[model samples]
Target: MALEIPRDRSPDSSLWLLRDGYQFIEKRARRYGTDIFDTRLLLQRTVCMTGAEAARAFYEHEALQRTGAGPARVQRTLFGQGGVQGLDGAEHRQRKQMFMSLMTPEAIQRLADFSAEQWQARAASWAAAERVVLLDEAEELLCRAVCAWSGIPLPEHEVATRTRDLVLMFESAASVGVKHWQGRLARRRGEAWVADLVRRTRTGELSQGPGQALATIAGHREPDGRLLDERVAAVELLSVLRPTVAVSRFIVFVALALQSSAGSRAKLEAGDLDPEWFVHEVRRFYPFFPFVVARAGEDFEWGGYRIPSGERVLLDLYGTNHDARWWPQPGRFQPERFRDWTGDPFTLIPQGGGDHYAGHRCAGEWVTIALMKTALAFLTTSIRYDVPAQDLRVSLSRIPAAPSSGFVMSNVHRA
Candidate 1:
């Protein structure tokens, strides 16, 4: 079937896709076949693709590049323009290497302990109040933890304010209308705030702390002899901060799952929280980066459709996560699927797949799993989620999908 551009300029279809995107992408792919529909955008000329092959191909395409105008526009606005994600070739590899050192297992283990300490303190306060918004509370906890680690010295009010602003920047960047402009403004403000922090740290004015590992590494040289300059270092730090802000959202989503699912809560209560199992399931089911945008680098034909060079392609992560061909009972949340299936690691990529051929995957996948495991272990065994009516709905289009009301919980009795 030939790829046909939608003649209707109405963005309702696209807007609807953005709202409940997973289901929309699934239904569309089923109707039009993964080959065609997966590459067709509902609202614009941008191509939307899914399936293992398309995803693999996009990441593997040599002519294709991630640090293009489309991505640069958003990344610069959201994560400072010229960081690793915005660079191509040797520059991108060099910057990525500089940041990778901070993600070492040893470093993550230390951070895990620190994160648990903060979680414990925050959980105590929530228990005292006997009620708290999961979203707000989680963001606060993560921001504080990140600040403590990064030596950012942000006050409670500033953390709250800046976090809200960053979240807005992400939302605006993802949405349509005047949102792009609004996102740009937020990005500018956020970049300036973070850049100043980086400057302070460099001059030794900001004391080195537990979370300052990334900043420290930013100043280090890679094995390949690549070093990150101050501006690039600042952007990399913001990249880390972006994920730090989102991790809490993912944590709350998992908590809500435990509350709502039949045996899930009971499992937590029983102290049977398997770190590997639960974390994998949560990532598989959650809408983290529902849609990843990429621009075609060269004219190519895949699945019979011709993608012109420089055209933007949006890969539906949510759609692929639920692709029946790749995952059986794709809609259901099952961690057991990964228990014995040790075949190809590429088959299941909650954090993405491949090396350079795969894509620029999340570096913190291991750390995220470890942190989530630690959080769940504490919450299930030590703290109790007592929200009267827990809400688990996700803002699908949001980059790191945060819950509408955040995960509100209370009742701190020992499990």
Candidate 2:
């Protein structure tokens, strides 16, 4: 039977459902099979197969490609025409290779040392405050860590203001109207700042710190090939900066999870839980990048539905992560689900699968997981939440719905 796609919109369109977006997609996909729905501006499609199978197929399908126009248009408006995130194929790959060198195991270990020290220093200040907004504190820690690792001179006050503006730009990019306009303006300013930072680092004139990641990348060459062009290099650097900016949210979400879940909290506090298991559970349970954008590379068939070439597809990361077939008690948080289950890596992807998958499956996974583990270890054991516990509210349908406020922490004690 052919999957029947509904052309008519639902009263409460699944488009607006962010927090539980995956659940909604799953229900609809199961009912309609792999059908395509119209979203006025974009095409929405769903895949109902289990994680491993669906992810593999989704990755292999020739029809799946990035909508470069959207990213390109936005990047041009915000950062000019040269960053790696806006490029595709050979260009994007070349830029990524340059970045990969800066993110090596030894390099990351060095960065981690810097990050840990900054976290400790920042936490000292928070310990003295009678009442502290944890979100602000976490952002400051992340900003300082980025500067410390990248050799950017981000003053504390400037870091606070810029981080807020950059976050708003990302938020605005997701929707239309005034927010979108504001996001564009913010992005433009951010791009100029990023370009200047790259230029200064490349010239060996950037003040503060010796041999940071950005400086290394700026100076590095392929050996077999030529060094990356400054424009492409700057864009790649911005790519690094953009994601690291969100580290605060990742840190806050993991902290909130431990603080709210008594069982999970006890395990962490007692050191009974494996760090890998806890991290996986946090990735699974926490809402991050729920939807990723892709366009059909060529015409293809899936689940009895014929998807025409060049059609847009939004892979619901949140839905796939929580698929009941792949995940038992799909809605529940369980890291042990991955402990003994011998399965394909593609199925367990919180990041997208395959080397070719863009944006979501880049080289940042190891660094991100390591960072989360370190932050959580420090947070769960060292600090205590002062307020009565409350539900971490998220629109299940939204992508990347973390706690609106950074999970507030106050009563300071080393465990």
Candidate 3:
């Protein structure tokens, strides 16, 4: 028995999505009293769904494929062309393994250690300043840390220029006009910058330490025994560098959560709560990635509705994280929820869901957690600062939202 999915009844909902932002899918889900619905976005029919079960079907069942699913704007900006984000099946797995190889426990700890060093060093400079915007400072800090960890040299003079380009890539991913064009330009420059590095590394003009991401990606060959196109290699490298810089947004949220959530900072300061728990809550409670896109891999029936092959499906990451069925009192910020966490990948997917190796779950998730925990400990225990009265509001209408004032801190000093 085929059932018709609830439809948005509009010829196009792209404007609505831009206007509604993070809540667009969930708002309609609530109104229709169903977890699944159909809509027209950008003049094409699309299916949107939320909650744990839908995610299981989307990821685990292999009901969707990522290739050609991402928007042209996203490909030109956020993801870049021919990167792993756009691959499928064997090609994706091979590329993904190359990424996961850099995520071993030792490698992750190395990144965290590098992050802590950056924080300590930056905090020293912040102490001398009258005020510091955390978002700006954190982006630069992460940009430096990731570059050093990845074996990419970041000369002192180019830090600001490189960081701004990386920031623009994500910031303008959902914007229009000038900002959108800026994102495209950034991607172009970023790719060219890394492609040159790839060329140099291949020709021995550049040397990298063993296991360094730059060297590994440059030397990696496809299953077909061909080297990645130099441009594609650059995209993969930026795939590493860009996302690491984007973690700065989460770092800002760590600061905001400590400021807003009563007694939360006290627990961290008093050693009553683990920084890991706080970091998890910040990811689940805040908005970073709103949703991920894919095309149905094959015709299938799910939730009493028939989904046709080639149909565009958006599995709502933000909405699923806040789904009441999986998260009790899902609207509230609670770090304690993870204390006895079942470790269900589908439920708390701030990145994406499912098995990291076999599926599309983000390979950098462990790195994000390690870096966020480091930042949390630094903010709560390693430093003392005053949050000046300013706009800390995070607007959901903004894709990849952050505080309006970038969470300013004044009179900073080491604790």
Candidate 4:
């Protein structure tokens, strides 16, 4: 009495997934002419879905759950174990609220102000250099800014090394062999670094002012009224720092758009275009997070197919943002397309979609927007630079793709 979902012929599409990268889910869905399909990945049967409709279903909180949903490699690397990402039910809501509390407009603006200061300092230094790789500089810049804002003490000597560790955590999420092992090692070191801080805060050896993210996390108590484990507290704190550092990728993509898109820089400079449109388009058009993993919490029927409880499901974040149904002329990099965007949560999710407080949508999404706007404004209004001739092609085949040359710039000067 149930329709069969389209299925991939391969015994295991794990290799294909690694090969296809961001296009794995959407390409198969396009081949089948359906938004949903079942395939074997990592030798386990998994359901992949995309498009706006599928996103809506995938975010149905009661139907899908996060616990036991993430793979071991990802858990060990990208998402530390026992973080809010793995919680569900009331516990998730409570932890999510803790994160949301830090996103108040004033708090976000304070972080942006800190980042702007970093940009100013870094840009001044760039003026003296013959050439600079924006990706590398931006990561360190955000690393310093987020640490100051979060009240995490990042000493001058440890800046580069700490930034590299945070970068490896996300950059190596989809890598293999030595690269993957490096990410695991980085996570262990980073966690230990913060866990010690948490212990110090509790023992009165360290102190941070009220409202700082580190203080908030260290003091956060569960519903049953116990402070979070020091390791989990460290993981939660890193969740704030790591994602802010990851925004450097988006900042590079912004520079790429300014260099590549015709008249985009002119429009932005002339004040005829808003930076939000530019940021939104970059997030939608480019590949950042490939997909989000979840598991069915109970048996449910969608799109004429029955999904059994415990079935692994993948919601394509990049593909859904690029889906032609929600985004007309989806392949083009037109920022104007968002001029009248309907603000559909499911459609524009480069980060995961759904309610910020209720569902699993990213908590720091507003912070991403604010910091990107800060970067955009800085690159456009406060400085001038020449993007040297280099390989600017972005490969959809690479997980967490970036320009091969890392968006090189030369002759930077204050405007």
Candidate 5:
């Protein structure tokens, strides 16, 4: 028997999508009393679903392909063209290997060391200032840390300019009007900037030490034995770079959680909880990306609903992370909930989930965790600061939302 998926009966729902942000699909699921629903977004038919089952199905290679899946606006900003995030099957595996190679334990430790050193140096400067916006500070710190780790030399003078540009690319990834256009501009400028380095690398005009990401990506060849276009290589580099910086946003949430959730913060201060658990809770509790988008690779059905090939589908990442069924007392901030965590990729995806090698799961998730843990250690046991009175609210309507005041602090010194 053919299944009848619930349909959102309304005109084009692009406005609703923009308005609702993280909760768009979950709101519909609640209203229709079903996890699967059909609606029109941006004047095109789309399917939206949530939960672990939905995610497992969405990531299956045969059921979905990433090529031509995302919106042009997102491609132009957040993802860039021809990066591994857009590839499928053999090509995806081949490209993904280039990225996964950089995730060795030694390399990730270097990321932690780089970020930790940068954070301490920045905190020293913050102590002299009357007030510091944590969001701004963390972004610049991460930009430099990642650049150094990747063997991309960032001149001290260019740090501020380059960091803000990268932030705009991800922050404006879901915005419209001036901000959206600014994101587009950032991607163009950033791509050109990295493309030059790729060119220099191939010609031996630039030299990078062994195991650095810049050198690895430059030398990587496709399974067909062709080098990536300079622009595409740049895109893949930014794919790693941008997300590492974006971890700063999660760091800000770490600060917020330290302030808002007294029990969790106390645990951290007492050294009773592992930073990983707190970071996991932070990833789950806060909103990063509202959803992950993909197009159907082939005809398929789940829960009796038939999905035709080429259908646009969105997995509600934020919804699934906060869903009460998977997360008991879902609204509460409790690090203890993750103590028994078995590493179910589908359940705890602040980044995309599944096998990192073959699937679209974020290649740098461990890096995000390592960096977040390092930041947490600095916050909990190393640094001392006072959270000033400000609006610390996170708006769900904003894709990749952070605190309203960017989590400002003052009076910083060694803990």
Candidate 6:
């Protein structure tokens, strides 16, 4: 029994979307007391859904497709032109396996180790400086770590430029004006850099270690026995590098979360709380990306609402994590709740949800957790810094947000 969904009455709600940002879907859902609704965005009819159940339905293979799913602005900036996000059916499954192959236990452990080593090395310089901007430093440091882990050789001088470019892609994915253009420019430049690397690896000008991400992706074959185009291969590689650097944003929030809750911070410092749980809670509580977009595949009904074919749909990743239906006391910063988490995919989707290899869930989910936990291990156990007066407030209206102060700290020293 499909029913007509609640529709947003505001004419041209695109501006409202800009104003509300992350709460664009959840606030409306609360007002209508529904988990799903229909609206118009960018002059296109759009359907938005929230909550864990909505996630499950949204991710169902036959119900939606990734092709033409994301906005053109997002496509030009964040995901690039042709990457795994746009593929569907057999192509999607094949490309996804290439990413999942790099996420084995040994590989994930190596990423964690790299993060710890890089953080400690970077911290030495922090001690000598009067103030440290953790976000900036973390981006540079993560670029170094991920490059080494993925077997991509990066010249030391190019680190800052590459980090800035990657950050621009994620930071401006939702922007409208100059910053959005900046993201587009950065992506083009970044693709050229990696496309050359791919070309070199293919021609034996440079060597990649056995089973490395670069080697595998460069040599991978599609179901039809064809190689991905050089630029598309570059896009896939950025899928790894960009997200790893984006972890710096979550790293900043970890510091902010710990500061806001002294009990949790004290427990962390005392080695009483698990750093992994703290990392998970930070991902769950903070706003990363507001939503993920897909297109409705073959008309379907969910929660008694009709979802028509070819309509742009959004899954509220932020709202699902914060929904009181799954998270009790959703506004509270509680790391303990994660200790008993049952590993349900849709429940806490700071990253995307559903099957990793089989569905659209982020391929680097393990890599992200590994990176953040390593940072937590270093922050809580190894180093100490004083949080001086600064604007630590985060504006929810910003997609891919960080603390306004970039989580500034000073008086740094080894713990």
Off by over 4 Å in 2: 1-24, 33-51, 67-82, 207-211, 216-232, 356-360, 389-391
- What is the TM-score of each predicted model, taking all chains together? 0.85, 0.84, 0.99, 0.99, 0.98, 0.98
Candidate 6, 54-130: lDDT as tens digits: 99988875879998888889989999988999989888999999999999999999988988899999888888899
lDDT per residue for candidate 4 within 110-130, as digits (tens), equals 999999999999887888899
Q: Is candidate 2 or candidate 3 better by TM-score?
A: 3
Compared with the true structure, all predictions reach lDDT values of: 0.66, 0.62, 0.92, 0.92, 0.89, 0.90
Better of 4 and 6 by lDDT: 4
Model 3 score (lDDT)? 0.92
Question: What would you estimate as the lDDT of candidate 2?
Answer: 0.62
Candidate 5 has its poorest 10 consecutive residues by lDDT at 56-65
Tell me the alpha-carbon RMSD of every candidate: 3.7, 3.8, 0.9, 0.8, 1.0, 1.0
Error of 4 at 111 (Å): 0.6
In model 4, which runs have C-alpha deviations exceeding 4 angstroms?
A: none
10 residues in a row with least lDDT, candidate 2: 40-49
**For candidate 3, lDDT tens digit of each residue in 264-346?**
88888889887888898999999989999999979888978999998999999999999988889988888989899989989
TM-score of candidate 1 versus the correct structure, residues matched by position: 0.85
Evaluated at residue 149, the lDDT of candidate 5 is 94
lDDT of 1 by residue, 273-323 (tens): 455776777887877666566676788777667777877776666777777
Q: After superposition, how far is residue 294 of candidate 3 from its true place, in Å?
A: 0.5
- The candidate, 1 or 2, that scores higher on lDDT is 1
Per-residue lDDT over 335-369 for candidate 2, one digit per residue giving the tens place of the 0 to 100 score: 66767866465656666766633432656766677
